[model samples]
Target chain A: LDAEAMAAARERHLTLTKPPGSLGRVEEVGARLAGICGECPPPVPESPAVLVCAGDHGVLARGVSPWPSEVTAAMVANFLSGGAAVNALARTVGGRVSVLDVGVAGDLPDHPLLRSAKVRRGTNDLSRGAAMSREEAARAVLAGAHLAEELVESGGADLLATGDMGIGNTTAAAALISSFTGRPARETTGRGTGIDDATLALKTRVVEEALELHAPDPKDPLGTLAALGGLEHAALSGVVLAGAALGVPVVLDGVVSNSAALVARALAPDAVGYLFAGHRSAEPGASVALEALGLDPLLDLGMRLGEGTGALLAVPVVGGAARVLSEMATFSDAGIEG
Target chain B: LDAEAMAAARERHLTLTKPPGSLGRVEEVGARLAGICGECPPPVPESPAVLVCAGDHGVLARGVSPWPSEVTAAMVANFLSGGAAVNALARTVGGRVSVLDVGVAGDLPDHPLLRSAKVRRGTNDLSRGAAMSREEAARAVLAGAHLAEELVESGGADLLATGDMGIGNTTAAAALISSFTGRPARETTGRGTGIDDATLALKTRVVEEALELHAPDPKDPLGTLAALGGLEHAALSGVVLAGAALGVPVVLDGVVSNSAALVARALAPDAVGYLFAGHRSAEPGASVALEALGLDPLLDLGMRLGEGTGALLAVPVVGGAARVLSEMATFSDAGIEG
Candidate 1:
């Protein structure tokens, strides 16, 4: 955060025509944008992009999710074809969609919107062994960071949003949140993608078993990611870190992104400052992660879809914050009392 | 709510690209909008207008507020000059603003955005007697409803948002909420515009005393309004009722609007269907009023500003809901299966 810019933004807020602090969180959002951009009136994040990180979770074999793992590849194809919820949301919010096949069990064909950045075909089932080797996890993280940098610097995106399309990935997210937040698996686990009571219970058990098998260390983010994190999780964490490094805002989606945020925050505490929880997910672990990060989501529509739809919906609000700071007349400018 | 249009909207939602209910509250908003417009794929609420009802509270004489009653007229001037927070937000959200001087204590000059609809110089001090006569309250409400009708029918505004510019109106709102919900004054009262702890306590006591003196009935909404409601409150309630009668969506601002909504709902239960709680107010009374009306606020920014700022900010989200329904590809069109 840029202290000078933040101070300037706060000063500007007090001078605006409305009562001081009457805009509440909207005012804070503007100030945060200023700090991120190192300018009193930060540039509006007009070019928004939702980066959908596609991966496959090996935990699906443990009956953790009712949907088949092939749904990941299928959803990736849907995203590329602009036939998914994220695509609709992006269109609605005037944002672009980019899909990265970070780790899919099946080979995905090249497409215009798809970026082939596979770290591995899939992770090893955490209940059986570590999800991935530490080197592979680090490579995935680097790939995500690099992609975020490229999108912001070269692709002309001013804001990056996180999205995921991995079946049974919620199990990994729950495990990661449980490990990082020191919460029990049952507390962090939730029904993903409209699972029934039986599947939810099974998913909870799978998360508990995986946590026991991995015994992930919270102190070591890389070790934790290697032990239980999915390839997409590591990549999304990279996106957060890269957004922080590049000083652009990163809007996070549901539980998967929240889990990734926990890992990113652990690796670089300052990264959390650049991140925005777009909306509260219906999943239980998302709240835990957001609480840990001390982020208040912009929306709570009970949305749990992980294709960046929730985050995409929030893009206008983020833009509005910047617009208010940049365009609103000050009390003196409008010849009104403060 | 129109059952035929609502049923059609539900059908349309089931056929949309996303899974049933995946869009969560957003999907509900779309359906409600459809019901409001009496058609499937309801027209986008493109032309939004925020009606800011300006008034003075007679209770200000009781030392319930630190600010002078003249601030109400001054703020009305500021609003007309586009120096208020409401104007900035309206500009940001691409909405028009109209300020109604329903009950300003002082005389006002004419302005482009100002509508002179004075019911009285102001209401009588509520702790001493009824705020206004029963007929005056009804006339104020009719003025609001008539303004809403004219704005939508002739002014080309497709949506109406409620705003208010009244000092010490929060006290009247708290009293109204306490009367309607049967909540204690202390539970429903909050510091308005940065009141000190001592002022907040005094405000609560004033609310309790007024309620005790009037013993207003929730069933007799007009009588209650005459007893405890501000002139602006009566007008806002009229706006809500008019919106319902006209079948146009009305986005409500904060506690003052919520209090009026309670009265509107009491007058016509189905009127609640046309209303949207734009954001959760920082004021304590807002939650009680929303709960009584069974409405969920779209934003929770801890904002206590009452100049339609919160409701104005919500314009885009409401627009997005309609856009998703009308523009997004359905499952069949996108060649995807739910």
Candidate 2:
């Protein structure tokens, strides 16, 4: 972050025609954007793109979610065809949506927006043993970083968003969040897709047992992801790293992205500054992950949908913050004495 | 609220590809839209418009805000010229902005978007006496209602938003909030336009004394406005009523519009059903007013800029809520069994 530009943006905000400190988080967002771009008024991103990563979880066999594993690949098709909730929301915010198949159990047909870069055919059932090899986790992370680079470079995307789709990914997310934050599994686990109490108890036990078995170190983010994370989790963490490396602000969708952020920050501590939490997800683990990163989410609409829907909802707000600082006349410029 | 439509929308949500209730407030917002329009997948607001009402405050004479009274008309002109925060935000959300000069003290030239509807030059100092006559208060309400009607009927606005502008308006808003909700001045009053500790103390005292002096009844909203409200407040309340009457969801800006909603609900309790709190204002009174009306603000960006900027940020979310419900394919239709 540019310290001088941040200071300049803060000074500029106080001079705006509206009351000082009245725009609240909007001012903070604008200042942060300046810090990211190293300028007083950051460029408003015209080509905001959400990279939705779809994968399957072998843990679905444990009844973590009622939906089938094929649902992940099926939803990717829906995203390509523009018929999912994330698609509708991305359209509303004028954000470009693309699907990255990181690790799906089923094969998928190609589309204009689809990027096929599978790390593996999905992780093994983590409740019994390690989810994936450490090498595979590293490869997944690289896949995400490469895709984000392609989007920003070839696609001309100034703003990058991380999105996710998987049936039992939330269970894996809970395990990772608990491992990274040192929170109890009971504290991090939540009802993914409205599970029954019995199923939630089972999911909680699966995560608790898995964490105890894996004992992945938070300092070793790659090792942790290989033990308890879905392949897409590694990829999403890679996206966060890519956004920070490229100096483009990354919008986080929900728990999947939030948990991914924990890994991203661990891998590169300074990447936290480049990340923007889109909304507070209803999933308990998402909140834990956000808190662990010390990041305040922009929206808190209880959205847990992780196809970058929440992040897309916040793109306009992030863009608007910059627009406001650049477009609105300052009190001094407007010749109004403060 | 339409019970059948709401229920149908709720039923449709479970059938959607995402997890049950995972979309959180987005789902609730969609169901609420259905209830508002009496149909599942309510019409998305393609032509959302924000009606900004600008006025001057007699309370400015008491040092309520540091800025000059002329800034009100100046800001109104800025809004008209599309150089203000509200215009930029409205443009971001694809909403139209039009200013209503309900009570600005200075004269202004005509513009294509400006509606001349001045009720009076300004209100009297509320601590000294009534802010305006009962007739003036009535006229202000009618001014807001008439503009909302025109915007929807002729301007093709399916979504209506209430915005406000006035010098020293927060003092009046604080008083109105305190009077209507029976909250104390200390709880409702805040620093308007960045007032110092001394100014906040004085503003609180002014509101406390005025409430004691007038003893405005919450049940008599118009009487309350005459005694303790700014012209923009009364007119904003009128916009709320007009939106409800026309069955158009009303997006409320910050403190001014929030305070006005208290008056609108007092006038017509059913109007609360049509009200959508765009964002929680940094002003203490706005939250107090929202609490009194049982409104959960969609955004809490700490924004207190009153040119309807906060409300404009929420327009897309409101519009997207409907869009998601209408556009997303059902799980069964997408061949994904839940």
Candidate 3:
């Protein structure tokens, strides 16, 4: 983010018609875009690609989510078939969707939209052992970074959105959030896919046991990810870092993506500037993660579905912010006195 | 709202690829759209017109808003000349804009988009007496209804959005909200356009004084409009009613529009079904109005701009909700099992 470009954007905002600061966060969004792109009027993000990272969580063995782990592969197939909510939303916003099988338990069939980047079959049960070795976690993170680079640099995507499709992944996400934000497991855990109260209690207990066993350190994000994070979390974190490194904006989805963002921020604090929270999730951990990251979500539809549908809905809003700066006539340009 | 259409939409939601209630408010929005238009898959709101209602408030004598009263006419000119934030946002969302001179203190130059329906020079000082006579208030309300009818019936607009331009109108809005919601004036009053602590205190006092003077009845909406509502308020209330009578969706702007919505709801409880809150305003009164109306705003950019900009941005989201029903493939249609 360039201070000079931000100052220029603020100056331009003042010259636009209506009262100063009247546009509120919309004006701030434009300024942030300008600073990120180093221009008074940042280029509109024309090409947005949502990366849906699919992985299985070993914690499913403990009955965290009501749905079986096979649902992860099933949902990925839905994404490929363009029959999922994320696909519908992305199509509405003119965004492209790509699925990456980073660590699904079942081998996904070959598909044009599905990218093969499996780090392992699945992470170990966090309640019993480390989710992944540090090297495996780093490898998954690097694969995500590479995918993001390919999408933005070669795939002609100007914006990146994070999505996740893994059954029982919310348990891993809650564990990550609880470890990073120092919140209680019960406070961070939520029923993914609307589970019964007994399952929710079991999920919370599983997360508590994982955190106690791992004692993940906040300062070392990779170590924490290795201890408690799912493969999708590493990949999403990689996507965030890649967006920051490449100077592209990344819109994060619900609780799973937000948990990944915490790791990404710890790895590179500047990465926070490149990220936009797409929506507040119904999950309790999402608020804690967003507050810790100092990002305000653009929408809050009480959505808990984590296929990047919420973030996809926000792409137009992000584009509108830039358009206000790039396309709108200023007071002086229209010969109207302030 | 049509009960049959709403039920059909809910059934359609279940047939979609996600779990029940997973899409949260998005599904609710789709159901509401179907009910409003009386269809299983409601037509996308392609033709949206933002009615920017311009007025003057005699309450400016109380020194509520820091900006001069002339900004109303100046901003109306800005709107006509396509230099205002509302114009920029409407353009971004492919929505048309029309400025209504309901009660500007100064004469505005004639333009193709400007509609001259001035009720009076401005409303009388509420602290002194009724803002307008009961007949005058009724006339203003009728004018708004007529404009809305013209826009939706003949003008070919599928959606109607409300905007307002009046200095010190926030004070009037706070008073109306205080009267209806029974909250303290200080709790509802806020610094309009960023006022200092001294001005905020004075604005709160003005609202308190006006509320005491008017002793407005919650049940009598027209009489309340006569007592404390601005001309734009009456006109906007009329717009809400017209949208309901005609079964068109109406998107509301900030505090002023919210205050008018209160009156509209009081007059016609069914009118609430036709309204959508565009964004949550920074104004305290906005929350009260939205809560009383039971409408959740789509965006919360902390915007205080009252030119329909927030609502305009939300036009796409509204469109997307409908498109999800109209365009997306169902689970059975795509051969996916739910």
Candidate 4:
């Protein structure tokens, strides 16, 4: 929906016992929900689903992250085993979380929540070649879109939050953002996981060199993304697109998801309106990407260790906004002098 | 609860496919909820209540707020009339907003959500005399305590949020912060609304004079609160106390609630643990008060306009944290590689 429709829905916020214009941002969220749902009191998606896409970045082979590429497979195993932070946060939000194995180097165990959509064994090292061929990238994006649509259509969720799990995805994201936003690599590269200054410099050089190799044209957003993006990033971009097409709110976690959003918005400007920045990460590139998107970070707690941590932090605020519109007292009900 | 219990609960966080510590803060919140409820999966309070207490601050008589004291009553009327933002936000949060007429000067109309418990109509102007006598302050506290019990015992509210509506509350809160923290008046004073520098200077003078006149003894928190506190402050202190006694979370707003929390915590340290800082305020004293109380504000967007706006913003976060513990997939269930 457009801002005007959201504004109209907001105009219909239920009168609480307290004076009008008193609750500030809480009130804003309520109004936004009203606008989004085209209802005076929007339906709170009681059954929320957070879909986390897992992949391994070829950039990690360039020695970008301290953690070995094996860590990606190990973490995916943890996600499938339900030992990760996103799993806990998703549980806290009363939503189910599923791991979409879009691209992993190793074979994952058969898990109920694990949906195998492995486009390739893993992305190619971008320093050597494109992360994925255009066909493989399309398959990853379609995988994400199909998953989001399936969840919404099955009445399994009222909201779909896109999360990512990849060791060097930030490196991939930095490269993609540089290509898409036409910014230099220095602005988009940051210390991914407490990397030393030397490693950071090296990482930046890798990104810069990859950007030069890719030379992605902004007009062909998907083409650029396919060449420079990781499986998780491309999948997240697809998720954002699907959420927008379905008119559902999609929360972006850190720079990784944000980089995907930048590409998504380039492809579909209307999709940007549905995106909410969960929080600002300590990652320098996050601020730059978020600013480029003209999005406001909901929380800032010096947190950059991703895995949807920031997005999970924002779940309550989003839920609360929808809840306020659905509940609370009206002025007529609370007959004080207000 | 101690940090160990919180950590223990965190350890019980539903495992995901990733390694431990992957989700970070989202996992922390879930674990925090578990520790608060002393359960592996805490039960989310389904019936939440936001108590918006309206009163006329004695300091308002000294030109602290540009808006007349009558606006407090007018806003209360708007709140009851369903024209206020709080009304809209509360509706979204699925909360019942109750307006307590603890100390409004105007003759409020009868309304369903409005409950009268006026303490001597209003407090005496602090510049002239003590804002309230010890007995009057106790009565206001008692009223708040009673309200909390009523909402929880009979009204079926699972969570309780403290809100307020009174002109010049910031003035009173500033005075309290100055007296309690032994901060200079300049350090504590802030522009309540969009006040000019001249009005702010005058407001600061008023706060200093009131602080000097009261000379509230830190040893006796209630005595200090009685001498300098607004009716709503006293009432809110009582609400925190009652919430603690009832084992419910008390979501706190800006400096006003922060001041009340200080008083309440002085009375019962356990109550301090029950409080969640909804958001930080633009008020200069707010950070001081929050720092003194060791509260980590959930949201901080330079918001100073209080009507329990901060706490209202935080409600969904609380709900979502509870939900995550209750609903998210565990390591075993999701079959990912945590």
Candidate whose DockQ is highest: 2
DockQ of 4: 0.25
* Candidates ranked by TM-score: 2, 3, 1, 4
Q: Is candidate 3 or candidate 4 better by DockQ?
A: 3
Query: lDDT tens string, model 4, A1-338?
Result: 65665665456553454434444555665566666666667777576677888788887877887877666777677666665666656665566787788998888889888888999877888866788888888889889888888888888777877688888888988988888777898999988766778889989999988888878888988788777889988888888999888878887888888998998898898888777888887777888889989888887756675777678767667776676566555545545433
lDDT of 3 at A204: 93
The sequence of per-residue lDDT tens digits that candidate 2 reaches over residues A197-307 is 999999999998898898889999998999999989999999999999998999999999999999998899999999899999889999999999988999999888799
Model 2 ranges off by over 4 Å: none
> Could you give the CAPRI-style class of model 1?
acceptable
Query: Cα deviation in Å at residue A305, candidate 3?
Result: 0.3
Per-residue CA lDDT of model 4 for B5-61, tens digit only, reads: 566656665353333443445456556666666666777768778788878876777
What shift in Å separates residue A24 of candidate 3 from its native position after superposition? 2.5
TM-scores for all predictions: 0.92, 0.98, 0.92, 0.82
Clashing pairs in 3: none
Ranked candidates (lDDT, high to low): 2, 3, 1, 4
lDDT of 2 at A311: 95
lDDT of each: 0.88, 0.90, 0.88, 0.77
**Model 3: per-residue Cα lDDT at residue B195:** 91
